[model samples]
Target chain A: MNVLNPHLKFQSQSVAKPYFVFALMLFVGQIIFGLIMGLQYVVGDFLFPLIPFNVARMVHTNLLIVWLLFGFMGAAYYLIPEEADRELHSPKLALILFWVFAAAGVLTILGYLLVPYAGLAAMTGNELLPTMGREFLEQPTITKVGIVVVALGFLYNIGMTMLKGRKTAISMVMMTGLIGLAVFFLFSFYNPENLARDKYYWWWVVHLWVEGVWELIMGSMLAFVLIKITGVDREVIEKWLYVIIAMALITGIIGTGHHFFWIGAPGVWLWLGSIFSALEPLPFFAMVLFAFNMVNRRRRQHPNRAAALWAMGTTVTAFLGAGVWGFLHTLAPVNYYTHGSQLTAAHGHLAFYGAYAMIVMTMISYAMPRLRALGEAPDARAQTIEVWGFWLMTISMLLITLFLTAAGVVQVWLQRIPEDGAALSFMLTMDQLRVFFWLRLFAGVGFAIGLVCYLVSFMQRGRVPAAVEAPAAVA
Target chain B: MSETFTKGMARNIYFGGGVFFFLVFLALTYHTETTFAARTNEAEMTEAVTRGKLVWEQNNCIGCHTLLGEGAYFAPELGNVFHRRGGEEAFKPFLHAWMKAQPLGVPGRRSMPQFNLSEQEVDDLAAFLSWTAKIDTNDWPPNKEG
Candidate 1:
């Protein structure tokens, strides 16, 4: 049945729908994981038996990566064919790959949830199995391999389509991003025993992939999709792409310095990390430029109102929340005070969800009307709900991040004096900071509600009528 | 030919501007190659300095102690070892002799592990340390302890 079904098709439309489901599932999973982690921070004993912090953290990070990939894959399926002006190459291979991917993703999630890092041998009555304790999360050998396989499968189908179909600069940029994803990820499989050196190499995998290359892919995808939907000039979109990529490189490389401050690295790292991290906001600011400029331009107004504004919303919010706040504490000099604090959480929550998550949602919402042809346009009031949700969740998060940032500064300057043992002082500071932690809990609840609104808005079709707003004016 | 030429031209101009700024950033980065106070790879070596270097290398001194900007930062900076040892003549013997003198093992205190060094190599290593201390680092390390 799976083989014979047309839904098993490899074409762009076939790929898009499944990828959308994959994205939403992973996104909701990430939010849940995030809330779990936040709760663990506030009350360590909250979910002790059910989900350990390590397990929850692993789930959180893994879900973030998975959902972003799903969104990218969907975008690739949709955009590549449209640019190529040809149908997707092989429906059968696509479906086969899809099932394989889905199966692998499930297995990996189960592994994370169930597999104990060490003492598996101790637990089961066998000494034969090696207790590679750190390997469970830090080494990440099996998960890394799974990710590599998925990348290859995704790249191969997309590559074949691009190879046979007419190609453009946008597709080329996206392909470059995918290739970066592949190359950088292979480095993950390498497990260095030296913890210090291993950290540097891991950053090569983690930092470079996100801030460096993935940014390229994301910028290209967002710009290309916007141009198509907005009917804007290709040159304007392409120009926006170059600016984004440039800003990404500038901040990405130096931004790595922020991670270096506490890790027993060279002292110069303090300077390097501070300077570049301070400038990290440039790309995000450029993101603002990218969003507002597009909206300001006169173009063929796409009839779908909610989805269109969300598309622009992602850029602005990412700029304010992620880019600005990311720059705020990424400086090693600044991070000397802020590292590992709740302020870091503040930066991450908005930046990632605002920038990447919004883009993914925007893409999914845009595709919904087209794919189902419900054009849910006249009734598609979900857009307003989603947009308002974006503001509510994001502003609450801003309050949380700022409160924590202030707490972090106080902790660093006041509590951690080398003359007196700082550990106890740090303890006292945390006691003082409990109020902000409570605020974070409050914000998390608000954010969760906002996310629920997002999911419900997308899901509430055929149940409640979607009074799709008439295509609103862009300005 | 009446196709939207103005918008097309504007996009081209925008793309060109973006490329121009990107190149400017790349060019600006060329000036950022500043290294630390002490030379990590020193070539100018005398007999005493070389043997002292052999001692530093043999012990893998970088495993714990940082010299100038290189090595681990767990212990205090040794870039100003000569001054810290109280001048070259005073410092050379101190490096050779400090090892034989071990700190009483206080339970919580972080102490250096003692490696038994022969009298001659200790002096050589001390001399090398003194020589390195004499080199001007141009007021680097900002403060003494870095």
Candidate 2:
């Protein structure tokens, strides 16, 4: 019998069902808002006195963060118990925290939309301990507090479950990642009055979350999925997880220095940021190697081809998007030209999509078939549709990155690199890049189409669930 | 494969290395906090500048604009806007006038919404930005036209 087979039928894993539901639903919202923002990029006053660009952009980014959190939480709820070989410590608490987090998230988005930001700030009592304005850290202090409370409760539930049962490497790494996520979030509360000082600490929350702790979470998740899909030896995959995460930390911790280079932090960051961030790609490279190697060395083949594809795609695209694209502008001299340009935007869009978005989809694709149909994988029809969705979204995002990168190169040439006459004004440069923005908007639509197909796959189940395929000899 | 790495060793590194690097981050943050006073010349943070900072925050200016290359890149970098538009004397008037201009309504061009800021709010915002321009950001933007 499969190791994962025993827990598949457990009621405790049912907690993950709702979590995945919310994650996918919010993912739809995120993509919709992303498209709106993409349109606003070209149309300028598309919403005018209504949604506006900033509000739409905020919703887009914040929704990405929230939905990914939901995905992570859901993944933990499902995998932790399975890996621990125990029932959840408290399913009721998991359900309650999910509701609380969802409600808080909904209210926060409404606050961003309904009220003017200034009024929202005033209403939220931002003055008492003002932490309202910063980018990505824009949630009111109360909302931030709610997040902390929810996170602690989540950690408690998962921690207790782990303690009661087995302590596997995957579970351990995941717990460490989750704990670090909660811990690093505390830095969001440290908003100093001085701008320079404010920026200095703000990155502790943003940079550390993505590059530092989240990598561990992502690595463990990938490892778990790889083991299940490829039937690779857990020991081999676990060691790879350790090595990958170690490199991720080794590079990623000091990689926070890159954000410090232009923020008036310190001069040494110029060198530190350049050298270390350049190496930030190492773990991602290793991931590509690890994933392909594991799949190639598989003792048996699992029928979840879509999941396996996603897993393989995650490693490769992450290596390219987060690793190579990031390295392109990481050095100080190169960053000086492309620091805040669309070059960064290009890297960010692809990196976040390739790393977080794709992996979550991988987990969802692998687990959803079982949860929904009580089958090992989605019916072949649904699997085909899901694969189509994958290629559409992945290819479109690549095009989007390429267009933005082209725009950024032109932007750097015309604006930053001074010419015979004075450099082009900001508006003039934006005007010049109109074509790229239009191309990006087109790609954005393609991404939306892909998202719809993905959603539709859930509806494409067969009349009867297929029998779970036994592991097939590969060699 | 040789049993070169153990689960126990991995766990140790996750915890131990995490703490060690966290300490390093704290040390860097401490250094940044202590040294920023000189870099930003915080002595210039007058009451108006403080109010201006509040005004900037309240309006979510960072949503569109980058200050010190830290916020959104939709708008130009405002960290050096004061110096770019010819110093505080010109910057204050320009910023105030700019705020009132709203939705520039120019076809196919990006527009700034009319925040309808009060005169004092405009002054405060301008003051805040003026102070922001003085920060030693290692001569960023590579030019004055930001």
Q: Top TM-score: which candidate number?
A: 2
Q: Could you give candidate 2's per-residue lDDT for residues A281-343 as a string of tens digits?
A: 999999999999999998887888989999999988899899999999999998887888889
Q: Deviation in angstroms for A73 in model 2? A: 0.3
For model 1, how does the per-residue alpha-carbon lDDT over A1-475 read when each residue is reduced to its tens digit?
Answer: 2333232223345567777787778778877877876665556445653565555665676678777878888777877777777877665666666667667666666665776533222343222321122211232344455667778877888888889988776787788778887887776654333223334445556766767777777787778667856777877677667656766776676566566554434565667667876777787788777767786783977766766677777787778776777877776555544455446656766777777777877777676645544543424465677666767766766776776676666555554324343333333455666676677778878878887877776665423233323334332
Candidate with the greatest lDDT versus the true structure? 2
lDDT by residue (tens digit), candidate 2, B68-142 = 877777778888888777684688788877778887887756667778789999988888888888888877878
lDDT on C-alpha atoms for all candidate structures:
0.61, 0.86
Quality of model 2 by C-alpha lDDT:
0.86
- Misplaced by over 4 Å in model 2 are A1-9, A419-421, A462-475, B5-16
Over the true interface, candidate 1 deviates by an RMSD, in Å, of: 11.7
